[model samples]
Target: MKKCRASSRILLIGAGVSGIAAATRLLQNKFGNVQILEAEKRIGGRINTIPFGDNVIDMGAQWCHGEQRNCVYEMVKDLDLLDFTGDFFSGVRMVRSNKEVIPLELGQQLYGIADMSVPKGSNAEAESVGSHLAEHYWQEIESQLPQVDRALATEALECFSRHESSILASDNLFEVSGRLHLEYEKCSGDQLLNWRDKGYARFLRLLMKVCEDEPEELGALEGCVLLGKKVVKIEFIDPDKVRVVCEDGDAFDVDHVICTVSLGVLQEQHERMFSPPLPAEKVNAIRSLQLGTVDKMFLEYEKQPFPDDFVGFFCLWREEDLKQLRCSDFAWLEGISGIHKIKHQPRLLLVWIGGPHGRRVELLSDKRVLEGLQWLFCTFLRFDVPPPQNFFRSKWFANPNFRGSYSYRTTRADELDTGPSDLASPVMGGDGYPRLLFAGEATSQSHFSTVHGATEAGFREADRLIKYYESCKTNR
Candidate 1:
């Protein structure tokens, strides 16, 4: 029975956190014949960390959202890898387009309202988060502030909404389901824990059981992964065998296949990739749930402009200012919600952009982006802006492998009564055995759109197969 389990050929698609987790779990369980196919030349799919100026910066997933119940946090909590310095909101400056700096107390008050305004999973009516938040926020504003402060408060709310859009990875909060948004189970504890100077790739290395001293090593599952192997097709050649074909014309026939591609990839390639085609419900789920874009622009300064303790600034644009800015090539600047200092990288500032503008910015050249940033700073800060020595931006939308950043529950998904579970259900072959399994962040019901969620999904699928083989052995 052990030999049979060991000899069973298994194939995993994609080398992201979920894929690596699945491969590691299976290998630990004594499943010897397992392989991973990564489309990109590099591993750590969305957890990309690269050297910028003097330090490294994460181009993909950055923070560990929480400590309690968060797998990533639990794994590294004792390792002293986390940095819980300053909260994201506290002491952060809020500046308007007219070069007005909002009073610290008022700014904190407005941000507090925005932070607590999100409903906590009890909305029976399936309305948009934006609708509920706007209604509640405006009521608070009218009661809390004088008429003179209302306009600034309104602009602040818009800025907050854009920031929320980026976190939720939606085009706008209006499209995200309020109830489903709250359905996400956040791990209790600090939500903004950073990895000090170590980038998010550290989490991936830990999953693979790689040593800290050997940073460039692949650790346990090194030879198991084949990079630059873009899987173009997956077909069930028979009840017991599945054929996997790559873009480079490489093919492998395995006993079982585990797919850990992103929801964005599934939405774009599902129809053409699967031979018999996925189930109707799965297809509907793929279309219903959205994968929105969230991009980052990293600017390296020759001279540090802000104080060492400086967090960042949130931009509040008045209606008139937006109207004027929209008329120029720098219209995309309006999409930027905030600019924050990267932890441990003193000379770098990170800009967060979301929604449709995220895709728009990816198409712009570095020169254009720098010019837009200069205009934005000169107008908002009312200072002579200096050009950044170097600039780096993520093109997740433009990259075909990752159509967008991450997945979110849409109002349409709630209306259609389809979600991650529908997309997660495994396909059974003719012999009544699970032939194809799906695992990724999108498949997680309670923890979707998180690294921990993706890691958990991979473990779930691998355990399912383990239980199946155990049952077979017991029956024999």
Candidate 2:
């Protein structure tokens, strides 16, 4: 009664935190065969850090993001990555209307806005950050900082706009649920989320360490991690076997496949790449998910022109500038708001935006980005923080593999089922077994905008697959 077990491989796509997390589990559990395939030349997806000036510059996912048992934090701690101490709430110096600088403390009047919620009530369901902030903010703030006294009101609205729109500007904050909005709103709320000294990019290195611990099974193989190899198509030959083809005309056979690509990539590029086509449910998840872009227009200053007491500053724009950046072609991001800081000693500025503002930046010209920066400095400092002698900003969406930065949403917050594991929850075969899977931050909707979400999503999927495979072994 001796029967042989058929051996098959598992294919993992994308090399971001999620991909690495899944791979770590596969190798750790001694899974017979698990390989990761990355479309880009580098393994790390969004965690990019480089030596800018004398300090390390984080191009993506710098914050630990909403603390509380995050996988990224755990992994980094295991690796002995360094952490720094700063006043999460106090180190902020805010820029306001009438070109005045202030602190971020919640004013008594602002507290009313804080407690205020949707028209239905504070406990209402579904709305966007913009609409929510606009609705409650004006009610409480205007009485205190009247429109006749435009400076404080303008600055308060600008700060709120900067915070709210930075996620998903297109989100109808008004329609969003009160509970979910307050939850995320508090996470990234006015209080600071401390900066890291070890740098977020090091977490990727630690994952690489885990994956490299054993080379025999899942190590970087010829068939796995095909750089310059854009994954174009995937076909499930049958339930127990799936085949993946690359743009360069390469094909792979695996027992099952996991897709960890960005939401934006899945949105526009999914149909062209996957074979037999992903079902409407999966496709809908992709379309429904929002991929936010938090671009940093970094500039290095030679002197301490701005205040030195804080690490950064937020800016407001002229009504005209706001109108200008809003043009579909202009993206009106510069008009909405921005952040300013320094590279260690020399001053620096990062005019950031997410949601509608972010997509608008992509449409803007470099001259426009530069102009936006200038506007930020002029508005806040009232003194032009001269254009950086050196500067750089991210264009993550343009990349075919990453269509944009990590995913998050204002309107979609109430939905908890969108976590990245859903992507990997076994696309069913005819007999009800699994076929293809999905895992990524976009899937990790609640934790969408950070490094930990991706890693946790990856680990969750890997464990699931290992359990699935173990069950198969037991059945035989």
Which regions of candidate 1 are displaced past 4 Å? 1-3, 146-148, 308-310, 472-476
Global CA lDDT computed for model 2: 0.60
Model 2, span 311-403: residue lDDT tens: 566554456655654673435544344465633325556667665566667667778777756665565565556666777777776667887
Candidate 1: deviation at residue 291, Å? 0.9
Give the per-residue lDDT of model 1 (tens digit) for 154-236.
89889899988888999988889886656788898888888888899988889888888885877889799999999999998
**TM-score of predicted model 2?**
0.81
RMSD of each: 2.0, 4.9
| Alpha carbon lDDT at 411, candidate 1 | 89
User: Could you tell me how far off, in angstroms, the CA of residue 292 lies in candidate 1 after the best superposition?
Assistant: 1.1
Per-residue lDDT value at 418 in model 2: 43
Among these predictions, the greatest lDDT belongs to 1
